[model samples]
Target chain A: MAVIQRSRADKTGIVIRYVVLAVGALLFLLPFYLLVRNGLATEQDITSPSWKLFPSSLQWSNIAELFNNPAVPMLRSLINSLVIAVVQTVGVLVISGLAGYGLARIPFRYANAVFYFIVATLLIPAAVTFVPSFVLVSSLGWVSTLRGLIIPGLFQAFATFLFRQYFLNFPRELEEAAALDGTAYWGTFWRIVVPNSKGFIAAIATITFIGSWNAFLWPLVIAPDQSAWTVQIALSTFLTAQTIDLPQLFIAATIAILPLVVMFVFLQRWIVAGVERSGISE
Target chain B: MSTVTTRLRGRHDRNLWFLIFVGPFVLGLVVFVYIPILWSIWLSFFDAHNTVTPANFVGLGNYVDMLADSAFRSSLITFVVFALFIVPTTFVASLGLALLVNRARFAKTFFRSVFFLPTACSYVVASLIWKLSIFSGVRFGLMNTVLGWFGIEPIAWLSVTQPPWYWLVIVTARMWLQAGFYMILFLAGLQRIAPSLYEAAAIDGATGWKVLRFLTLPQLRATSTAVLLLLLINAFQAFDEFYNLLSSSGQYPPYARPPLVYLYYAALGQGQDFGHGSAGAVILTLLIALVALGQGRFLGLGRRED
Candidate 1:
């Protein structure tokens, strides 16, 4: 009888835990649900002064309307965002990867000092360089171009540190065997190291991609031209004071987050581990 | 003779390899990161506008002006208030979530992903979702609809700041986006704790609150400290959501502006005062550095694991 009672108590505990979790999950999901619900609602339906959960009719065409709107340039901005995010991710990976490998594998005389300097730069707030970086980019006449968006952000101190830490654990035998076969440092890195370090590279790449895709302030100031504006900057254009199109704005937001949502759903394991790794040091 | 020549060639090759491997990143860091930081500091001391070059050398004038400006002063207050509200709320919420998820028996990965999905959502997008869809002043909106169900009158969530209910929007949006990430950090910390400790505690008849207090919380000290520090830094970097949701056409209301938004307006908005912006940036950086340093010193962020 006592064992049965204990099992019953355990069942109740499990039920209570799930009940609490279900409520919390609803709280987390409510915003996304609201976004989709109103995103397909008519402007009149949305603005009407009556409480309703779902629209009488689903306006699936709102997505088309958002893309068709000339002021937002949704497609072009998406292309711009894609270019910026991809280029910056690739650039940081190459730059930081090379530096990490050099610091970890190469026995250069001043490697320790150089690594220290790079890590110290991570302490300096991005705000400290915010305006001057803008000015420098502008002075070079690179503003409103992909070069401006992609170049200044190509090197990441945190990502470099992450790479260095990972590389420190990399097995030396493979590289040594390559060296014994007369493979140079560059050749070994390109042929063996790069192929072997794909997991770390993917983790770093995902983190960098999300950051680049979501970047707002720098792109806002630099990419003044509609053609050069990223998806984030383009989404902000819908928020002007003149008129607030609720459906259009929601649609834009949905579109803005859709790629990230998809990426998260697909690569969530790496993304979560990457975020934890990034915070583990600091 | 050939061995000596080969040794010399090896030295030459090593030097070449070092430059090839490390030179690009170093040069990029020097020109883009270090140079801009120094230039920003220099610009803070002078009167600059529109251009990168400071037109006049005015030592401490911009700093004095920034301190005197009521807008900038209030922004500092606003940041403190926001940070105070967000830091503990997030810490507790994430810890609670982590503890609950840690004890969950089923669909652990599913629960983890559901909570963490928002961390990947961009602030700009999340802000719009809150501002436009959920918290919109319309009676038919999400929050208002829920209120209607309780027979309460519709509330204009984004407006009416005498009591500053708009903080609801800002606070909830940020918490939803960030709490899961911290929860994952806590979960990672939780997983690191040895099961033996918990088993030993249960053997001694410690259960419920005692186990949590003695075994769990103490074990998570390092992770908790790191989470708190990261939260503090991120709180200071508050710009995107505030700017996107609250700012109208790149101009912000005085009530909701944080230091970064205030500095953004001073530098980029109609006034275009780059000197003041740079000064404010420098001040903000110093404040963050001081906080981080204090936290590190007191919390032993750098203490060796003896």
Candidate 2:
């Protein structure tokens, strides 16, 4: 009798759990739904008191209008954003991967000290470097240029530390076999280590790409010129009081965030796994 | 083939390896992060206005001035208030979401990804969506539309500051954007807890609430502490959403200004007092350091465990 009662209770429990979760999911997804819905709505439709979740007419022209918004240079800014994210990701992977491999694999005097220094940098608040980094970049005439956006952020201490931690736990037999076969350390890394670390690389690259794409404050400070602005910086210009073009702004925001949404959908597994791996380090 | 020559060659190879492996990142770190931090500290001591270099040496003047300035003081207060509101609420929300997601027997990935999708979004895009489409101070805004179903009148969700209803917009937007990431963190923490502990407690006649309190919560202490510390740090660094949402009208409202936004205004906005900005930055850093150090003290961050 008790077992039968407990089974019935478990069935209802599962039902209750799903019901609650479905509601929570709706709450979480409401903004994105509104973004897409309103992006397809006209300014008249958006501002009208009558409410509809779906737009009566899809404003496909809004996309064209956003891209051609002369004041913002949406296309140019998108290209700039792409370049910054791609270049920054590749640069960080190479720099951090190599430094991480060295710190973990190579036995050198002061390696631990160097590792500690890199980790120490992680503790310092980013605000400390904000103004001075701008000054340093400005002094070098990098403001309003991709060089300013890309170079200053190329080496991430956290990414390097992540790579080091990953490498520390990596099995050493493969590397040992390579060494026995007369392969050098760098060659072994390029041939064996790099190939084996595809998952880690993908995880880190995805995160770095997302972060670089979404970066605001640094780019906001350095790239005020429309020509040099990233997509995010360009998107913010729509919110300026004088030019509150609602439809155009919604469409532009859709364009800005679309890549990330798509990427998250496809690469969801690695991103989650990557974060788990990093969390384990703590 | 002499011993000394062989030793010299070995040393040369090791040095070459070091140079080839670690040189680029160390060089970038030194130039970009370390030196600039030191320069910022130096710049804080002088009356450097708009320029990196100073014409006058004013020790403690900038810090004192910033403290005395009402705008800066109020901005700091706003930051604390904002953090206080965000940190605990997100902790509960994420923890709740984590537990719910973990309990699911099906579509776990679907629920997890749906919740986490917001974490991938740019604050700029999210803020614009909230400002223009959702909390828009209009009768047609999303929230207003829902409220209308309840026979309520149109309310200005973003503009009402006397009761600070704008906080609803700010807090919800931030919570929506961040809660998912923390949920992921908590989910990771939850999975790390061994299943045997729950089974063992159940065998001992402990049911749902008791098993959770005894088995789960105790195991989650480390992850929970880390999550809180991270939330605290990220809260103090708040700028993107607050700036984009509240200051969409071009000028920041006094009610919603956080330290970073305020310092931006003081130094780069009309005031152009770079030294004052650096001083504010230093003070903010110290506050962050204090929080980090206090957390680290109990967490034993500086200790060598291995």
Predicted candidate 1 versus true structure: per-residue lDDT over A1-282, tens digit per residue: 987998898889889989988899888987888778778989888877775677889999999998888766889989999999999999999999998888788777877788778877766667546777887788889989998988999878778777777777788998888776667778789999999988778888888999999998889888889879999888787764557788888877787788889999999878877888887853
Whole-model lDDT values for every prediction? 0.83, 0.83
- Residues A203-263, candidate 2: write the lDDT tens digits: 9998889889999999988897888999998888777566677878778888888898998
Give RMSD (Å) of candidate 1 vs. truth.
2.7
Q: All predictions: root-mean-square deviation over Cα?
A: 2.7, 2.4
lDDT of 1: 0.83
Residue B110 Cα positional deviation in candidate 1, in Å, after optimal superposition: 1.0
Tens-digit lDDT track for model 1 on B261-303?
7777788777667788888888887787788777765233222
Report the error of model 2 at residue A130, Å: 1.4
**lDDT of candidate 2 vs native?**
0.83
For residues B1-306, write the lDDT of model 2, one tens digit per residue: 245434533756766676678778888999998887788788889988778878799999989998999988988888888888899999999998999999998999899998999988888888888888788778888888888889898778767766467777888888999888888888988888888988888889998788778888889988888888888887888889888887855677777888888877776776667788888888888877788877764333333322
Q: Give Cα distance to truth, residue A213, candidate 2, Å.
A: 0.5
What TM-score goes with each of the models?
Answer: 0.94, 0.95
Q: In model 2, what is the error at residue A279, expressed in angstroms? A: 4.3
Q: What is the lDDT of residue B178 in candidate 2?
A: 84
